[model samples]
Target chain A: MNELALKELLYKIADDQLILGHRNSEWTGFGPLLEEDIAFSSMAQDKVGQSYAIYQMLNQLGEQEPDTVAFMRNANQFHNCQLVELPNGEYDFSLIRHFLYDTAEITRFDFLANSSYEPLAQLARKIKGELKYHTLHANTWIKKLGNATEESIGRLQGSLNKALPYALGIFEPSPLEQEIIASGFFAGEEVLKKQWMEKVELLLSQTQLNLPDWKTIQPVLGGRVGQHTEHLQPLLDEMSEVFRIDPSAEW
Target chain B: MKFSKAEIFTLLEDVKDPEIPVLSLVDLGVITKVDIDGEAVHVEMTPTFVGCPALDFMKNEVLEKLKENGITQASVSISFKEPWSSDKISEKGKAALKQFGLAPPMPAHLFTDIEVMEHVPCPRCEGTDTELKNPFGPTLCRSIHYCHTCKEAFEQFKPVS
Candidate 1:
């Protein structure tokens, strides 16, 4: 791929991480419990750190400065998944969202860890280590909520029902998907989706919750293509407020 | 192509934990083995905690630092055997912790008998009167405690895994 195309791909990854990190940060100090609050915040910090690395790479590649790419972009220009754009509704909903995202991300990072692109491969290796902790955190909650009181199980099931469609949106392909796959930057989307489903299914089997039938669920579009839900605008507004004030200011 | 072992040990010491920046794995007492065979250097490390985020960062930093110091073929092997513990911290590391405002680990022998004593003496205040608040602190490695004498809340690093 050309430099422009590569830069766009990098931005897509960075933007996804930035938006998700921002969304997750909203839960700081407000999580269901103290341990969870710290865990969520830690995960949010990791996402922001990952975004920083990608943004730095983009700047080095001469595409645009990190601030310009992160804060100056329009909502429609962001390439994060639609699921990450959705606001954290309830604790159960947030857990559901986390479970789905972490499962997919684990598979994604595993493939990226071996990318032919040296920098990406290195970042992926670092990210994969952190991602393992995230997966464990999500899995702990899933199992706890799944086996807890009937009320907790009911609430968790409701969250899964509501969020699963949007969770599927995370797999939406970019235009450079073929090149990325061919270059060994990532495994094929189909394979990734399958792996994600299998992992999710395995976890679900341990709980009382049932996996939603794939055929019945309609996939939400956008996110990967820069289209976003209504919730993204306010999030972008808050995140970019500082950068928008003085674009030239050193962060 | 011959190099002294002491030179390579210094290179390994230069690579600090990325998250904790101030503590090298050696200082943290997480480095389990360092072997030099011909031109290749191999370093083994155990995590301070089972799921530390700094593991990969430390590994990469070790490789880069070794290469920069003219050891081109350095290998980092992670081991879980002989898991790291606070007792493994060198005397110098304990002094560094006290200097850095973190409470150093109490002598391992003290922990067994002081099960009921909720507060250890504040390393800063030298006061035996203190209270334990939250077991979890800002980071997984710390626990929140308050010093009654100094009227300050501080994070104390927990025992290493």
Candidate 2:
């Protein structure tokens, strides 16, 4: 088995969940409405829990403790795509990001569900089940906001366009993409991206939103390789504030 | 005197969900397995939601219930090997939820295939003309629905799959 490739794959997936889950958790008490506040927080818990599970798998593979690995990692050490780490600009942007990112995630879980790796396939089953609601939440709101009043439609459309490039970055090829694919672990990002694009197009079509042709967009890349936006480090620092107070202390 | 799955299940019936106390963990299908080995009792569980805070509470409750029932040694573990679905909820649990003024969970297949159900069938009025007031409710496990006929708003358990 290609351990490095598998570990790298796990890192990216785990990081994506953790970072986005952190961002979503910020919505607690601050969502556009009370229901949305609870909804985002609910999904945030699932995302964080999912990340913890995958990190536990990593610990089995000889990585650090889940707490140390997650709370101690610097921005550049993270393997999550740039899209997940970006600031939640507004409800419109946050909603758009959720829609675009989750579309790919559910697809990734589907691919991983049938992976030759037994552990990943098992984890995928549980993760996919939880992600189904997240995508459902995103799609329902996207359609509602995408086809709503002029202001709502305009806000979603603006955010959608701004988020497209970053969303494409989610499929940035891994350093050991081929090794991972050759081991029958995953079908590779190219396949996942195609499926994501198709799914996104289909859903976007249902609303008044417009998606630009794929060929014309420059995909934002580099979060998988540990490169990240300015937004990540501050978030990480804030996250680990209490944990860093005393690494040896138990909560 | 000996312990069996039937009695163990009966003992666990008193362990209710923290959020919705009307239904027991067994009724929600969270208690998937109960096994007896010599003097050790092993219990396997799955959470209704991956992030349900009540997981630890439920596990502790199970252990306490078993110990109180004279099974002093017991272990309760959460299993994530298989996904959980609302379809696993018992008929008694569904009725309990409705009688408690909360709508029962819809079939898993019907809930996930679409964003929201057009007709939720209000728990109070049994009216199919209920509107999805919001796909999200006060809690993660439910959604808000309003019955136009009864002019009352209620919550339905969101099908988890």
Candidate 3:
């Protein structure tokens, strides 16, 4: 296996979970409803915890400790797609984003469950089962809000349109995509993207939301190669503030 | 200085889940394996959830239990080698969970459809008429449900396949 390619794959996966987990945590007290609040907070714990497990795998492969890797990185050092870092605009946008992003994630982890890499495959298999609830939560809300009142439908549709481009960024190909696929470390992003699109389409078809032409929507890329939007640095700064203040402090 | 695998498991049975104190790690099925290596004992375990905060505490408790049992040279490792599922929970653990006012998870085979979560039997009233309030709950391993019969909300130890 190409060690660099493997690390890159792991880093991107871990970063996505960490960043989105932080965003989910932002919903801790602010969800539109009490259940939604607890739901997001719970998912936040799951995602952040999942990210920590992945980082531990990275550390075994010669990266920094999980805390250092998670808390010390600048925006440019992160490998998360831009989709996750965008501020939770509203309940509508957050729900749409969650639905789209989690669909891809569950699909990705499902593929990774069969990865040629033994350790990752094992972890992925376990993580895959846990993510069922996450997708269930996302799918339920998307369908409910997507087919409800005029305001609810309009808001969800608008957010879905706004989020699609960045959601597409999730599949930005790595330079070593072929190598990773060939080595059986992963099935590669393109395969994941295709499967993800099908699943997304299937779910949205059940709702009142519309899917726009794929060719017309440009994917907002660059997050894979460390280029991120202005929103990312501020998130990182806030996320790591407590850790940076006392790196040596025991929790 | 040496202990049998069964003896080590017996000691570990005293170490209950920090969150659900009524259930032992053995009954909960997190204690995947116990190996006796001459004078040193090594145990393998897996967490119910990837992000369960109680794992470290569980590991420490295992160590402490072994030490109190006079098996000082013992070690515990958390791994995904034998990944956990709700099905792994022993019948005894399920009863204990219910006794503790938390519903045990449905069998993994019956949990393929997420709809099963919507009508979990209430631990408090054993009422089948229940509604899933949320799939996520106070802890990573639980889900919230409301029982129409008892007019109370309860949690279930969520089933993870």
Candidate 4:
């Protein structure tokens, strides 16, 4: 790949993580319970940390400094899916989103673990390890909410139904999808989407929740290609405000 | 190769954990790889956990250690693949944990075993009659437990995810 393409690819990956991390962090102190609060916050931190690593890789590739790459990107340039950018609705909604995203992330990281790109492969391996715990945390809550009061189950089901279409946005392939897959930098997007669906179906079955009709929902858009909801601009502003104030200042 | 394996290993030994200054991060098994090319040394490491608060400090520690060891052209790179796990704790680090009065973690897979439910011996009292109060303690890594015999509360490292 040419330098510009590689840099763009790295930005897409890094920006996705950064946006999702900011969204998740918004739940730090507001989760329904204390243990969950800590767990979600921890996951948010991991997302940011992962983004930081990707940014460092971008720097090494001689694209731009980590701060500029993260802070300077306009909303449309971000590649995260609409699923992650949506507001944390209710706790159940957040959990539903977490369920879908974590499962997909685990599958993606598993493929990346074996990526032909040595650095990404190594990074994926590391992220995949942490993801095991994330899956556990998300699964625990899903089961709890699924088995709780009728109200809880109803809420979860509603959230799951509402979120499923947007969750599909995560699978939207970037323009470089072919090159990335052909170069073995990542697995084919369709295969990954299939695996993700299988996993989601299995998990839903375990929870006795109905699988949303994937065929009927209009797929949500804007994440993979950098189009995002209004939620992102403010999030980016808050996240980068301090860094932008003094780019030369040591963090 | 510019540097011998033994010399490279010794230089890594100087990479200490910023949180716990007494122990080298390598001894903690956080340093995963060391590559040498002539006079250049490249070190690859991961944090003790994802989003560890001490990551920046640890990164600087690696660079400082290599520089202090006379490696002028050394580079320390960070990775997140195969994220750090307590399972990677070196035997030497395990011993150090024991000496610090923190019980080494029981493997998560073996957590359901009755043997693991048995009280961990208190480091202060050397008594096994302890009761777990809760799974979370002072840190994400520990659980709060108390020894009946010693009448003292102690923290035990929980087998964390």
Candidate 5:
């Protein structure tokens, strides 16, 4: 059990959930429909809550408290894939991003449920069930709108094309990837990416969406290594604004 | 005053869920364990949903109830040691939820598909001709549904395996 490998793995997972959870929350009042609004907000709560739980695991391993870690981090410190931090452009883009990202997320956690790390395995077991609804929501809309109108199909296709490269970034190999895998902490990102591709392909096949040649797209990497887009800092600033004002204030 | 583990559980029966007041924490199946060590009581609980906002309130309520019963040296800890599933909700809790106008979840073992959410029996009319409007609801642990028979919307405490 390499502690550093475990922490690195935990940090990336937690950061991904936290950032995307914040993005999902942006749809709270702005969903195209009332149910969609509540749906995104609910998933946001689930994701953020899941991140907090993982952060607690890190804390048990000697990391800072969850609030301080979440609020105090600069954009460069975040390990979330750039795909998640990208602005939710339109209903089509947001929905497509949700579809692409959650496909990988559910698969990742499913593998993680069997992690050699017991604490992580237990947490992943719990999280795996909650993610079902997130995937269900994403799949439902992708099928419905993906087959609905010409405009709907075109818009989704455009977003899908735009998001795939960044979505591929989700599996950017950790520096300790082999150690993490050999230690049984995880099965590694390569295995996860293969399964993710399969799942994504299956879902899109059920719709009118097109997936281009996988080999042609160069994955926009580095998010797992603390590299992120310009959008992240502003989002972090806004997210931690209230906390920075009074770090010790009880909410 | 030393209480036995069973006795501690009995005392916890009075601690109701803050959101669903009709349901006790014991009945809701969140009280995973209660141990008595000397004069101190240790209660281990798990949340129905990890992100449930009512978790802290429920934990405090359990502690407050123990103190109100004169057990001052008590502690409560939250964990996933015994992760909660919808199946853990006792029959009594299910009845209480129905009476409180919320449908209880079906057994998680019964279905692996999201379609299981469809056609749930309406808590109001006990009619199976219901529709799953949305899988997400007002709370993390619930889902919104509509009863065609009753012509009204309701929420179900969703099943999570």
Candidate 6:
């Protein structure tokens, strides 16, 4: 294994999950409905927990402890795709983002479930089970609301169009992309992006939403190499608000 | 006799799930193996999910329960080798869940079928005329459902695949 390549891959995956999990948790008491509140929080816990497990794996490879790594990292040290770091602007935007990002993540986990790396494969297998419902939840809501009413459909369509460019950033090719692909670690972001497009296209076709010619969309990249939006640092600061207060205290 | 495997196994019944106190770990099928050597005990378990938050608390409870049984030297190990599925929840656990106002989990295979929600029996009235409030619930392993018959809402322990 190209160890550096592996580390890079892991960092991006873990960071993406951690950041998005935080965003999802923000809807705990603020969802449009009670069930949605619970659902967002449930998925939030799963995503955060998934990130924690990945961080533990990184620790085994000589990274710092999970708390230190998660709470203390600066914006430049992180490697998550920018799609997950954006604010949950509204229910429509948040839902659209969830639908897009999870479509790609589920595809990634499916490939990882069969990975040559035993530990990652094991973790992937378990995570794949959890993600089945998540994607299912996203799909059901998209189908229900995408064609429901003028307002709902219009809102979703608007957010979907707005999020598409940033969603494309999820496929930003890493420096070790080729090596990671060659080493049998993963199929690379290229394959994942292709699979995601097909899945998203199929799902959107069932609703009133219209997907623009994806090729025409300009992908907003750079989050993978640690360049982030102005939104990320504030989120990080808020996440570490309590942790930084008593780093050494056993809670 | 100092502690024996069967005795330790029986003693483990005292450990209850923190989230659902009505069911014991044994009843939940979380306890997979139990071995004993004199006063020392080794117990093996599997959590409902790989990243389940309750894993640590469950293990500590098992250890604590063992000590309460006068067995101090105990080790509780976890593995996803035999990943937990909802089918493992015992009949007693199911009954306990229903009586506690929560529906027992459907089989793991059913969750993928979408039909699992179409007929979730209400724990409140045992009514089949139920509506899915959300397929997601407060916990990772639960989902909310509403019963039209009794005008009540309940949670179902979702099957962990």
Q: Which candidate, 1 or 5, would have the higher DockQ against the true structure?
A: 5
Model 5, residue B12: distance off in Å is 0.8
Worst 10 residues of 6 chain A by lDDT: A113-122
In model 5, how large is the Cα lDDT of residue A49? 96
lDDT tens per residue, model 4, B67-140: 77688888877665545667777777667776777777766555542235359778677788997654444444
Query: What lDDT tens digits, residue by residue, belong to model 2 across residues A144-246?
Result: 9899999999999999889999999999999999999999999999999999999999999999998998998899999999999999999999999999989
In TM-score terms, candidate 4 sits at 0.83
Report the lDDT tens digits of candidate 6 across residue range B31-69: 988877766788899877665899899999998887777
Candidate 1 — what's its lDDT? 0.76
Segments of candidate 4 deviating more than 4 angstroms: A2-9, B1-16, B33-44, B62-75, B79-85, B106-161
Over 4 Å off, model 3: none
List residue ranges in candidate 6 displaced over 4 A: B1-6, B35-40, B113-115
How well is each residue in A1-251 modelled by candidate 3, as lDDT tens digits? 68998999999999999999999999998989999999999999999999999999999999999999999989989999999999999999989999999999999999999998899999999999999889998998888888899999998989999999999999999878888898899998989999999999999999988999889999999999999999999999999999999998999
Q: Which stretches of candidate 2 lie over 4 Å from their true place?
A: B112-116
Q: What local lDDT does model 3 show for residue A67? A: 99
lDDT of 6 by residue, A157-218 (tens): 99998999999999999888988888888898989999999999999999999999987999
Second chain TM-score for model 3: 0.96
TM-score of chain A of 2: 0.99
Superposed by TM-score, candidate 6 places the C-alpha of residue A106 at a distance from the truth, in angstroms, of 1.4
Error (Å) of candidate 2 at residue B137 is: 2.3
TM-score of chain B of each: 0.87, 0.93, 0.96, 0.80, 0.96, 0.92
Candidate 5 chain B, poorest ten consecutive residues by summed lDDT:
B107-116
Q: TM-score of model 6's chain A, to 2 decimals? A: 0.98
| Model 5 Cα lDDT, one tens digit per residue, A132-223 | 88998899899999999999999999999999999999999999999999999999999999999999999999999899999999999989
Interface RMSD to the true structure, each candidate = 9.0, 2.3, 0.9, 4.8, 0.9, 1.6
Q: Give DockQ: model 5.
A: 0.79
Docking quality (DockQ) for each candidate: 0.09, 0.48, 0.83, 0.33, 0.79, 0.56
User: Which of 1 and 5 is the better model by lDDT?
Assistant: 5
* Index of the highest-DockQ prediction: 3
TM-scores for chain A over all candidates = 0.95, 0.99, 0.99, 0.94, 0.99, 0.98
Clashing residue pairs found in predicted model 2: none
